[model samples]
Target chain A: MNILTINGISKNFGSIAALKNVSFFVPEGSVYGILGPNGSGKTTLLGIVTDVLRASSGAYKFYDGSKPVNEIRKDMGVLLETPNFYPYLSARQNLNIVAKIKGCDAAEITKALKKVNLIERQHSSFKTYSLGMKQRLAIASTLLGDPKIVILDEPTNGLDPEGISEIRQLIKLLAKEGKTIILASHLLDEVEKVCTHVAILKKGELLVSGDIDGTLSKKHGSTGENLTEQKEKTMMEVVSDDLEKLAGVLKTLNGILDINESEGVITVSCHTDELTAQQVNKHCFDNGIILSRLTVKNKNLESKFLELTK
Target chain B: MLHLLNIEFLKLQRNRSFLILIILFIVSVFGANYIVYEVSTNTGHIVHETSNKSFRLFEFPEVWQFVSFISSFLLIIPCFTVIMHTCSEYTYRTHRQNIIDGLSREQYITAKILYVVSLALFATILTVACAFFIGMLGNDPISFRDFRCVFYFFIQALTYIGLSFLLALLIKKAVLTIGIFFIYSFLIENILEKNLNRLNTGIENIGHFLPLSSSDHLLMFDILKTAMRLANIESYAPENAYLTASVIYIVLIGYACYYLYKKRDL
Candidate 1:
């Protein structure tokens, strides 16, 4: 079932577009993650969904069998940004107010507190709680009434290892219960571990999005071609004053593979993909030209993000 | 509405500062009464017993009037109240959480309005009660006889609370709103009145139309006195103008608040 649909969503702040033509769908009962940099539009997307920020132009619809988005909103709980609570109120009181506002059972408060493992600190004022505790309390508050869709933005931010693991476990457990969770984070590893599906955004534009492993696998495949095929491909970029000379000399060597010089930069692909650094240096030395820089090509999220966003 | 009210009440209950503020208000009212009673007696500004023996403590029928006067400064409470109430939401970033927790834009705004009204009414009720008890000391029987007076205090409080909410909503900063409120309430009005006094003509009357000043005049002076003052200052009276201007101010403020809230990213 489609729990949420956002079509052609665009949001602009002054002249800077925060989100542009961003469209995505969240299937029911799937853990969806939005990955992006600091200025990326992940938070903006979540904000628009929760109705905290109106999109300049877009259509968003949520459904649990033909009910309106408002009804779906009632069923979904969101935690955007940092934990915010009345400093003077106890955790239990805060959750109680949330439950009341959401028109849910007060008993759900206890259940939520238990879910976040904050039952012990439920009676403590928010001000006295630690940062991790406060974050957990926020999660607990969102989990109230057992909302199906939980959108948490950077949930484990500034947490210790133990706290991060605890929250990761909690999120996994929530997903196991068939809850639809949207985790927006800058940390790709965190998303990789917790989310079954991922969307990458850059400069208000979505770069890539789909199943986590499948998406990364496809990106990796582009860089995973055989060494000989890659060698004949002239895939490495080199910049030097004597690029023509370097290309001319590299063309005759047995392991020279393919060399293409364009705009004063020589692209050389060696037959050995995993050659020792010293061997490449000795080859450059025998060529009688400055090597400049040698880098081995590898596919990772960082490189893929750079390639797509750049 | 009940759910909104319940949430507002719960928020108020969780706010320890609110409870402390209530305690302070009660003390301030009692203290103001004691001081006024002592000062009036010492200065012979009032008689312990009237010539007719009907109205006793002071020229005014009740010492609660003095408490009400004191509560006018309690306008400071609401000014600061909305700052802590609304601006803190921005400062602490709870607004996003609030929205995510099923707070529709309308419900959030309505909740604030309801909370402000509730606290304003409570403060007004307590002040009027203080007035009632103090008036009883004058041998005037306190019961439903003075409902109008109490109701007047309620309206006065509502007006201030409304003004405070509007200011806080517009300014969106506690320090700035409180500062502006103080300047508008005390400095600007006094300066305008003094500057107009030099004219020796109708200009002072315009201060009445300004926010809070007109309401203060309506609450403090009787209709005849207000009308006469208006007539003297303007040479002609705009009978419907006062109500019209107040309504316009309220509507404009309400719309502005809603617009800002909806437009703000939060």
Candidate 2:
């Protein structure tokens, strides 16, 4: 079941359009990532759905078996932009305020602090926390009340490598506990690794959205096919002592769809069944070119993302 | 509403600035009472000669009026406190967080109104306690009429603090909101009142209808005039008019705060 559905949502800041007819759905128990470049309205869309900002047009609904958004929000935690809390208060005190706001038991504060690994420093003031710790405390606030859905905007932004990995692991752990997580991030690699489904937005418009594997696979022009399935055309890289001659001979093959040379390597895309390694090897040898390396490569999300977004 | 207030109070519980503001308010209240007590008791230097009836500042009904007047001078402290508390949410962006955490916009505004109400109640309670202490120490007879000033005192505090809340909501910045509030209360309103009255005798009484002056007129504390029944000096406007104007201002300010909060994006 879809947990949240946003349809035709748009926002305008006076004359400037921020989000234009943006639409997406977050499925239950799925790690959904909203991916885009900066100023792509990722944060604006999140703000609209979370009630931090009202949409200029369109509507969104949280499907929690007929529960009101307010009640649903009690079971849904959100961290937007930054970790907003009273800086004068300690971490525990801040979480205590969250607990009260959510009408949850105070014991959840301890549990949340423990989850964020801030139990030791729970008494320290929020102003004294490092940026990474501040982000972690924000994550911990979302963990309070054992929320069913958690929305984090750029959860891994501005963290050290170790802190990034720690947050990545924590997100995976939360997903393991059957919680649906909606994360917005510009870090393509992070979204690719951590998200099960994604929606790429650009200029306040949704470019594409689907399951991670399916989206990437579809972008490479092999629709509804497993990533490993050999398609009509397969990409292969070859290197030889006579790089120029290998490129010339490879272009002469009947099944060759496209060919390009880069850094002494010739990348060839050809009909999979017609242009086998044996055919390429023999043709190269017959042409006085000794093949040094040849291997088939599976496309990655980075390449597909660059292709689609570009 | 109760839950939201609980959350707001919890946030304020550990706030060092809020604590200091509360302490400062208490000290100012006591200090004002002390000064009044000293002036009333040591009358010889000012009075030139002792009369048959010794002038006592805390004399029962007069004490309530005196305390209420002294306390009104310090109303700016609570107004500043209310502005800080209301505007800090915007500064920290916790107002947005609270809505994200499940509070409706109306609930957010209601929570702030509750905070203002709480502060007004605190000020009213302190005024009544100070009045009682002074009355007891002076060995004066107390009456229900004296306690009526405490009611006006509560209304006055609510009026001022409610104005501050409205300013905070409209401005959303602590320094700017407080600055505008102080200027309007101390200078702008006074100038407008004087100038408007000077423009025509037909509307000479219009100045008394202005928010701050209207509320301030609620508790008249001219001890000398009240004791001597001076013929030349004008007495305060009828109490009902002042009370009615103050209540109207409070409602208007409260509605304005709610309207701004409801219409704006947090």
Candidate 3:
């Protein structure tokens, strides 16, 4: 069953359109990723679905669209944009408040804190937490009551390498438990790591959406047949000190599907059958450059978008 | 309603600013009464009935008026508390969190309305308790006469906090909402009411119809009217007139808060 179905949801702030006729469905038990850059309406769209925001025009429903939105929200946990607990309150206190709002047992607070490894420091004020800790606390709260679905917007944002890795592991674990997770992030790498289905948003528009696990070929109203045919493509992560130059040069390479640069690292999804890592390394070397790091994975989302719509 | 109150209580029980405001509220209530008592004692001229006798302001029924009047000023403490707490939910973005966690937009506003009502009731109960305590220390028989002012005080408390809630909802920031509420309710509204009252004093004194001024007029009891008669300044608007205005302002401001939260995006 689809966990959520959004229909023509549009939101506007004055004359600036934040979301324009955006629609997508999140399948139950799938890790859905909303991929976009900054100012791309990822957060705004999430805000609308979460009911904290009012859409100028449109409709949406959850879990078969039968229950009231408020009732539907009880079974779903969300961490939108930022950690939004009272700074003066302790982590435990914060979760206690959420527990009351959701009408769950008090033990859920302890379970949530322990899940995020914040049990020891749950007594600390939220204002005193590090960015990573604050994010973890938000995750802890999001996972309370073993929610059927979790919506996290940029869940790993502002985290160190270890912190990001930890959150990714936790998300993967949650997915293993059959909980549907909808994660929004600008990084293709983050989405590629955990998401099974992906939606690409650009400037308040849906560029494309499909599954990365090869099942999108028959998705409703999908032109994802080419996506299945392009299964041989590889995702390559390349990092160098000069990222802007690396990203700029990789675009000229033939058969590159998609190039995403973030934090001095360039991730390229390419046709591995036509473009080999050796060719990439040699091309950089011939251009008076050295390859610092390179790793290839099985597949990617946007590369599939480019392939499906090619 | 109880569940919503529990949610707010869970948030505020550990909050430092909220707790500090509660303390200040208690202290200010007693301090204001003590100041009035001291004036009545030290200066035979300052607080006396027109019969040339020094009337104890803390005796039985009069204690109700005295404490409720003090509570009118003390209502600022709770009103500021309401404004600060409500606006901080916006500042901290927890109102969004609350809605995300299964509160409908209506429920969210309902929770706030319940919160405002609780603060008003709390102030009212505290004033009533202080009245009983002060009246017990006096020689007059304990009576419920003049106790109706306590209910009017409750209405007055609702007006102040309801207006504060509206400002907090419309403003969505603690510092700006508190500053505007203080200046507008205390300063600007006063000037407006004074001028409006001057415009048509013969037709029920329109100044008493101002939002806070309507409630302020509720505390002009027999003693206050006697004192005003001494100054030859008539508070001619009857109690029922002020009562009607206070109730009307409370309902309108309460509905406005509900309407603002409903129509606007958080």
Task: Name the runs in model 3 displaced over 4 angstroms.
Answer: A213-271, A274-310, B45-56, B200-202, B227-232
Candidate 2 at A22: error in angstroms?
2.0
Model 1 TM-score is 0.78
Clash list (residue pairs), candidate 3: none
Worst 10 residues of 1 chain A by lDDT: A225-234
Q: Which stretches in model 1 have alpha-carbon errors above 4 Å?
A: A64-70, A212-303, B41-70, B140-149, B193-204, B222-248
What is the C-alpha lDDT profile of model 3 across A110-165, one tens digit per residue? Answer: 98888789999999989999988999899888988889999999988888999889
Instruction: Give one digit per residue, the lDDT tens place, for model 1 in B65-105.
Output: 44566567666765566666777777766666667777788
Give the range where candidate 3 chain A is weakest over 10 consecutive residues by summed lDDT.
Answer: A215-224
For residues B169-196, could you state the per-residue lDDT of candidate 3 as single tens digits?
A: 8888888988998899879998997788
Chain A fold similarity by TM-score, each prediction: 0.72, 0.77, 0.77
Task: Write down the lDDT of every candidate, Cα atoms only.
Answer: 0.71, 0.83, 0.83
TM-score for each candidate, following the candidate numbering = 0.78, 0.86, 0.86
- Kindly report the docking quality category of candidate 3: medium
Sort the predicted structures by DockQ, highest score first. Answer: 3, 2, 1
